[model samples]
Target: MKGMIVSRPTEGDLPVSLDDLGAAARERWGAWVTERHTSVVPNAVLTLEVEPPGEPEFTVEVMRGPRSINLDGTPVQNYATAAWLRSLMPADAPRVIVFDDAWSMHADLTYGCTAEGLRAGTVDHSVPGWDAGDPDLY
Candidate 1:
């Protein structure tokens, strides 16, 4: 999910900036900024590589979509990015119920589905983790 800096929490959607999502991913997802490119798309996605223990290290694009953190090969469709982030830790922890205080972490679960161009320029085919021929989002 995306991140935001709100003056006050509103019941409606929170205004999330590209930078906000980047900060949140770095802070909560154990992600390190891999690349910052303007040519990626209108969103100008902030790509981050996550090296979770025991799991294949992969990329997570912050500001990936309207309300999601797009993982490279291991895409998380409707799931909470924060929970998925934490799940990638040394071990998967119990899922936490996301509250209003942390809406960015709360997302629905659509495992492995990705939007077009989500992995456009970010995947390194030379790398072993993302060479699954890619998936066509149905």
Candidate 2:
């Protein structure tokens, strides 16, 4: 259930400083986020565990770069969770893209967030030789 979260902010809307993005994982994930022992790449990353009570717990590698924080973890299976994730995006972010590995052509898992709202769709994994028509055949 791996995935990538990317956000690109406009020049005029960029945060004044990286520090302006907030300092705590709680700021982004709320009180459910807990610090844990996990190694990350040699970059500014926050390794934490998100345990939302009854829901399955997952690891989140929040990589903060010069502009936005990159969130790496599992994909949301429902629209409620997707909307929650979108709500956490920084105000400077004009568009937020999320790519989920468990996505299907009919699943509304892979999506993007913008002023227009959450735009969800599928990823075209169609390859030249893998055009079998039957999805499972691939």
Candidate 3:
């Protein structure tokens, strides 16, 4: 049986620092979040990976320079789409709100979904982001 859960800080509730965001996400994601590994991409780009349990994970990647973000991993079936994730994020103070909020995690749970139905896929095969277990994420 395969399953997937996707969640992030609700609107108006964002984290201050990148580290804080990751930690907050880990906690909200529940006990599934295990070890964390940090890998930076030279300057401002960073890639953080939590314990991977051979299941597809939802990832929200923020990049500097142009200051664009990419929500990768997971498919359109099991979890929330990239569009939904971005919309849920706070429009103002994405950083400060996360740290201040209590539970900043939003999940896509389909009621009456069986374990088999929970199996998710990828949104983009050409280029996948971090959480989805795609190498191009970093």
Candidate 4:
């Protein structure tokens, strides 16, 4: 006898911040660079839209993290992350697949799931959106 497994897709929002990402990386790797140090590094906050085979869009944040400077929260689990990515699939889209880090723990579970997609290359990375620049920070 043969068995088959099927998964369904889900839809929701995902929030992310770079504020604690640097610290987290440093904590895990002992050495890490802040986003400000990398020209390619995205802004501190972002909202990613996920849809299988479809381009994802990045929206800027109107407000900063609760801490004002850093974020605080629990990281998303691998299974939950994978489920969220699967939810982004269209009826005919291929099975959602992902493998990456989970850094947006401070973000809601939904957002954390989406972050997985972002890291896994499941979501589009070409969206041109970012928070307004602050001269003081620069």
Scored by lDDT, the top model is: 2
Q: 5-45, model 3: which lDDT tens digit per residue?
A: 23332333222345655566566555655433333533334
- The digit string of per-residue lDDT tens for model 2 on 1-138 reads 445443342333222233433334468668887764335555544555677777766654445453333344434522334444555545554444343434222122223433223334433445344335544323
Once superposed on the true structure, which residue ranges of model 4 sit more than 4 Å away at CA?
1-13, 32-36, 40-138
Clashes of 1: 5
Q: Which residue ranges in model 1 land beyond 4 Å of their true spot?
A: 1-14, 31-35, 38-43, 62-69, 73-138
Candidate 1 vs candidate 2, TM-score winner: 2
**Weakest 10 consecutive residues of candidate 1 by summed lDDT:** 4-13
TM-score of 2: 0.47
lDDT digits (tens) for residues 1-138 of candidate 1? 233111211222223555665566667654433445343645535666666666556655544332334444343322334344433322322222222223322221222323322223233333554435433210
- In Å, residue 56's CA in model 3 sits off its true spot by 2.2
Q: For each candidate, what is the lDDT?
A: 0.38, 0.43, 0.36, 0.28
